[model samples]
Target: MKNIVILFALIGLLVSCSDEFLEKEPFGELTDGQVELPENIESLVISAYSILNGQGNEASNAFNSPASNWSFGDVLSDDAYKGGGGTGDQNQIHRMEIYNIDGQIIDVVQKWSVLYEGVYRANTVLKALKNTTDFDEATKTQRVAEMRFLRGHFYFELKKLYNRISYTDEDGNYLSNTQITPEEIWTKIEEDFNAAIAVLPETQADPGRPTKYAAWAYLSKTYLYQGKWQLASDAADEVISKGGYSLTPNFSEIFIPENDNGEEVVFAIQYSINDGSPSNYNGSIGDRLMPPGGPRYPAYGFLRPSQNLVNAYKTDVDGMPILGNVDLTETDNVDPRLDVTIGRPGIPYKDLGINYEESWARDLATYGPYGPKKRVISANHPDYLPSWPYVTAANYSIIRYADVLLWKAEAEIELGNLEEGRTYINMVRERAKTGCYIQNLEGTANAANYMIDTYNDPFDSKEEATIALRTERRLEMAHEGHRFFDLVRWGIAADVINTYLEKEKIARGFLTGATFVAGKHEYMPIPQSQIDAGGKDESGNPLTTQNPGY
Candidate 1:
């Protein structure tokens, strides 16, 4: 990030050039003192938020550093597949899906680059705030709080994806990656959120801006990641008891473009289309490759739902998750969320009035026959861009109310409060059971055997409660990009993912060599380019070190 921001000073230095430089105001041509002006400071803060979609004034290359983390989060997990033309299409991602990942991969470098770019932008705003004077004191404090909130978010992503990233702040303090511990990095993340919480307003006129409740939600998540059970639970309780967020009536309705900023969303990346931009830069540029190729939604098909995730949704006669081996290829009584989350062969997809068929999926022989349905706006909607590089205006929520409920549940279970945990789990289940489910093509019949029920009774023990909690989280949060991380955080990544690859390879032959190594694969290998460029040590080695087993 420091390398990318090349600040230059001019003393009327000029080079004669062609007459095609737009003949307009140059981008970021401000002097250092002018950058600290009140208006420019406000623009810089907005600039920090602009990177949330992971685009940087370009129309392409978004797949490399999508803020959604679809590549690292969903494709790396058992939840989805690298479903494009074949194994060779975007083959780097194929290498990731098969666990042949290398530190030299583009995703490793670009994702790291974009996140640090976010940190740099946030710090730039903070630095400008520290020097500006004409700004109102109250508003200055709020903007400072907002920048810290964003910096915390960026560092949180860095901490989870990279584990031990270099840390820097507005006051010019820089801690090398080798010099900082993951625990210290986590502490820094918490400090930023605490600073934000101390000054932010309870609400904002602009829906995308963080509120006090948003900071609390993020803090709860940070504590949950660190296993601070009591602190995590308390922070979640603050949101639940005081935050005015709620679940929308229908499970499927929450994702449509109309509800992008609906009640359930706590913090989201704002996106829009047809807002007078030369391209769909303000749209879901990162997720352009995700739309399933169908008559209604015509686009590249990537991130197909894995059959393992489909099997996880199967229910028994009592609407409880079937813990035993149910045929991974077939479906029986299942939760309604399965249809809402994934597009299967015979289901009526959205409001298109046609059934999703095996023909709709690309590279079906390699990736199998399923497409992601959640967070995918209907092709007929105005928010979808129909031209080349199809994108959408639908927003992506970084934190949602459902996530808060589940965090509290997990903390409760870990703290030995099984009944309290079950109650929270039941709340999520009850919404799926009673909410709007997938209807038939004509809207006259039911789709699949929708048989979902809540956990109305007590669990026999903590082990049983823990299993229930994890399963409910998977079902409720499918394809929203929380599957693999959930498994890793619980320390069962090796067991669960290896078991998945074993069973799934039998159905899809392409997964023959995929493996998940516990100590090494828990976090991605640090980008080799970063290590090479990250200064030097006394022994002439790169200062930044790689994660274990890299």
Candidate 2:
């Protein structure tokens, strides 16, 4: 595959021109004659990788189609709030947060467009590879595998967001609206990943490229989401036993610039800074996530962590979560991850050496007291480019080894391997216990009485293990944007989110009447723009149907 630098340069040219003249075709687009050359084919494959950051054109920020999914996966769930200037400042996201979304929302339309746009790019590469005969058979097979992996990832995102979607391939032919079921989509996704696995190497020469192990990890997750316990467990086992991946010693280290593609990262979106491009394509979403106006950090303050999520970190005397207990006391022990994930009162904020004050919040009355810490980089850090200070160079991990272990535990428990499940869960918990605690600037004391202990005994039943797994995942993956989807896959989005809204409404008055309607709110409505645009079939019927609610 071609490097990201070349890909980025080529993407700018590709999206601009679409004329039919074969002699003047853009560098990014491949004509029938161009596909026969190995170099041109490689560039096409690299173009597919370039859109991983969701940047199609340079004019607007790709907020709706960000690789992070912070809006859809985190804010829409209990993990965060749509915190900006106010509810009016990205009301569509707020509507999503409050379960008041519709088909006409621009965020919905952009997200749908960008993802399908990704599918189109991947299909382009696949088509080119299929037609090329100048390359060696070995190279051809490998390139095909890589393209499939990219396509699988794009489809997986669509599958998780909108349960019922149209399916398409390299020919640009899509199934009639809602013709495919979620299970069928899952099967296709699985097939793509499996094909990638057959030819991908265990490790890639380039850091951003996916490997066989990355495919395995994703395949395992795909199966886990579908409740295919045995398949999920086996796939996870293959990764754990042979993938050679390990957790980063410090949880806080995972997000820093120096650890861009660390050992803990299974796969991550590669980002570069000072790449001579004024476009924020290489910059991270963290630029917008900084506290609205702080002494050092300045940002829009979106995706604020919820008080319920903050409270969920509270632990009992035994270093376990204070489950079923709402009355949090000063003496309540809590997981260290709370400090690592969120910025609250009196804690050192993102290596600034100054405590995060409640006054730093844009509007405490509307959003909350907490701000997201996981994505913010210290202004003092060397990677903090003055050119675009808001857009840091932090690479966001799509899958980490810790995520794999947790999924493994979930699958094991579901498959009746209770003790084995406990072992995997504890491995993650044990890793969390060490080198993860933040400390005072003086380095003389723990940040917030941090304490986290592993489960010493076997879970009494699968339900017990399930609760532990769910809570562990929330605390482990908090602001990284996996909470909502996890809740949906567990079939408990309604209960978990409604209960969350009830508590949150009392704290953040903006969520006064918020409620998660079970069946309908589980998936977002299909974009109206897509429906209006070529969403109809041969009989003039709508090819793209709206989701049940809107």
Candidate 3:
């Protein structure tokens, strides 16, 4: 949390509209004393939730700080390309795509800023709630709990992306970046979530508010990241057994605007396309660059799926993954999720009238022809906006039920509970098997040799189960922005990415010498600007030390 968090608040509102309200200073604003009222303080809690979508009051490019993590998570991984007009369009991302990211990059700066803004807002609520007198005791505690949940979320993202980030709360708001140890940062994140879980309700009247299970799901993920296998599995079990969430039967329907907060979503950043903010800032603005150009929906065709990702879908006769040398030629069978996840050359684009053609892609020569599908709302839907800012009311889920189930599987496998893990993995696979299959232009038959099946269980070695679990997670969460961090945590980033580059270079020449350096490239550097402004240590050096090679 920073000392610069605004102290004023308006009653009964919390969102992008509040961005405008918060910007108004001195004239026609409530006094700092007036803001201590119960309703105004409650409004502060809601305002904390607004920053989750990555838009600050400024009109700067929100795509650079996209809550979707498309640029850092997907493009930096083997899953996507910095797709658009050419290599020069949003070139900072191009440098990021090739693993040549620098501390001065716009994304490096803005992402750090936006996440800290979230922290600031959350801490503001926590600080203000402590002073309010008229608010109901239980309600105040509930608001405090929600703020902690949100604060925990922001720090979790920072830890994952930067590895060792500064930790803060209202109590120690101005602590230097190096004040906490790496282990202490994780402990702080756990503390926030654990505190929230003790008070947050199982259900909220508002869909946007995270419930107890949401905190538990995140705690499970936090433990998984740190390799606390038993704790991770136990946390995941709490969500699975008690959260009452299920896999949305139709995988394709999950991303649709109407189902944005459906049963599958454990917690999500709620986005509203026409939310009365003149600029549509409350919409998923950070992902504004993702909509692929086509006859029906025209927008920047960025976040293009990579050829390597498409090939990973290839399956053998038993509907199992065929690891290396995945031959996409000869009508080879591929997982059905491939069609549900990526818009290929011949598939009907999200059930819109026209088929996806090569012309739909902005640069066929450079990025190749595969537009991302998971986050894209159908052009035919009413929420569709054929313009800027993540363009739809479709909420970006921070944690999905399937994701929690997989976390359990991953933890179980790591904990040597192979059979239990296999069952959990199969639950997600079973949904894909029976739920949906991509159909042809007329919606007559399977689009591509769709052949996906569940894995055979029992007595399999941890190695085989681990492979199956990792493959399932990649296929399920491909473009929603979890791939790169997953690879890094598994300690296989260097091997996986270098191999991907070696083969991928044959098709996309831009990746000729790209390499994922072991210790350094796993985490992005602390922004140069942050280091300059973050004050100094006792020895007259910058307080924030740069991550390894940076």
Candidate 4:
């Protein structure tokens, strides 16, 4: 494993060589022995983050492009729903039937390939570091831990979306004829995370490095997927108890750049426009999804919020949106997070002036009651953008303290510690209200709304409580991109999503051609190319079993 670190350092050394050698770049063709210098290895290791970029880039704004279509399928198809216009290419997502192959091969299949490629690279680093003699023992151990953490994280994505995913070895090759069951893959992921927990330092020594707590946070999620409630609870608790993380008083500040690196974030994807290219799609998620043809110029508000979700926000104590108990309008102060979570068309952006003209050709709208407002970013002004007040690059939170606390609450409830569970839930709620950025939970009534009766008991029955918890998870994590994964893990995608579709259609008054397929559609259709490469299952059939329906 240390050999991998040494290998990277070697690559960096070579990269620093004379202009001719650097420009000509003979290393790709060179033998390992020929290019075994310290600098080359370092360059290669540093390049691994680019592989992650393949999962999300600047053009798509991390919203789920062609690569993240499964995320959209798992979410928009049934658990949640949205309808918008794009060219056939763009509209495919709206219709929930997106699949296309491009000339460069950079689509969903490529993303899957690249994720596994990342795994192979990390494994190579781990194996090299294990055998390297030149690196210090401490450095070797830490490096191995980093690779393991990365490897586990990659596999976690595949397992969640695709169910059974193929594993690879150190040399960027998949194990032939190997098909790991979902449970077996979880076991492997746990093993990798556990190894990371044992060896990673408690704090990061550099940007993007994994820490002991990062390992624990990821393992907590892994355990939850595997149905190990106690273990998941304990792992999250471990991070909360001593990891030096805490909830930020203001939930919005966590997203704003001026307040980044706060207590709430455990691990976040680092972004810098001046340092390099901003994420290709991540920088544009909001604008890409904005409503089309409105006063808000150049915005294509894509992620439209459902009226159902908008109504979910109970009114202020006095029952007004921005004020008390008045007839709520589209723009209400019911839950400030609703604006922060999902943007509605009629809602004023506060910053938009009469001079602004929105770009609807790209599906952006600034006026009228039609556009989505969540996670919209401005290349010029970030004070209004969720990611930050000044930064162009939106930091995607991979793990955060708030999630751990919520998980603690859920696990405790499932374990039958109702009081303890409520305590954890309240901790999150209290922070929301008292934290400088957010208003009173019920708005200026008790100052601590959770202490009051209205917002206190989220559900009537234990089953209802579970549903409430899941809903909270969905709302809290929306657009940070966790909703789809949560639905799939619980195997509730079909029912939840199809219900949403019917509601969407009913709301929009569309009667005919409304479709909801259950069972296999809950899981994504396997990429056609993968089936082509692997052939069929037992019956010598095409792998396009279609999950139950087309």
- In order, the Cα lDDT scores of the candidates are 0.82, 0.79, 0.82, 0.53
Look at candidate 4 and tell me the lDDT of residue 441: 35
Question: What would the per-residue lDDT of candidate 1 be over residues 426-489, giving only the tens digit for each residue?
Answer: 8888889999889888788788888989898898999999999989988888877777788878
Model 2, 1-550: lDDT tens per residue?
Answer: 2235425566654533221111123334545676558876777777778777766556445666678888888999988888889999878888888888898786777777677766776787787777776788898888889889999999999889987877888765667455878888999999999999999999888888899999999999999989999999999988999999988888888898788777888998887766775555566733344444578766578888888888899987778987763745556688888888998778888777788888888878888678888877777886665444467677889999999999999998898888898898888778778775888778788868888899998899999988898889999999887999999999999998888887778768888888888889988888776666644567878866888867
What TM-score does model 3 achieve against the real structure? Answer: 0.94
- Which pairs clash (backbone N, Cα, C closer than 3 Å) in model 2? 177-543, 287-390, 535-543, 536-543
266-303: candidate 4 lDDT, tens digit per residue: 87655434332332222323223443335433334344
* Candidate 2 Cα lDDT to native: 0.79
lDDT of 3 by residue, 402-509 (tens): 999999999989988899999999999999889878888777888888888898747469999999999999999999999999999999998999888988899898
TM-score to native of every candidate shown: 0.94, 0.94, 0.94, 0.77
Clashes within 3 Å, all models in order: 0, 4, 1, 71
- State which candidate, 1 or 2, has the greater lDDT: 1
Residue 318 error for model 3, in Å?
0.9
Give candidate 4 regions above 4 Å deviation: 1-27, 34-36, 55-84, 87-89, 97-107, 171-178, 276-297, 315-333, 345-374, 378-391, 436-461, 507-514, 535-550
**Poorest lDDT segment (10 consecutive residues) of candidate 4:** 1-10
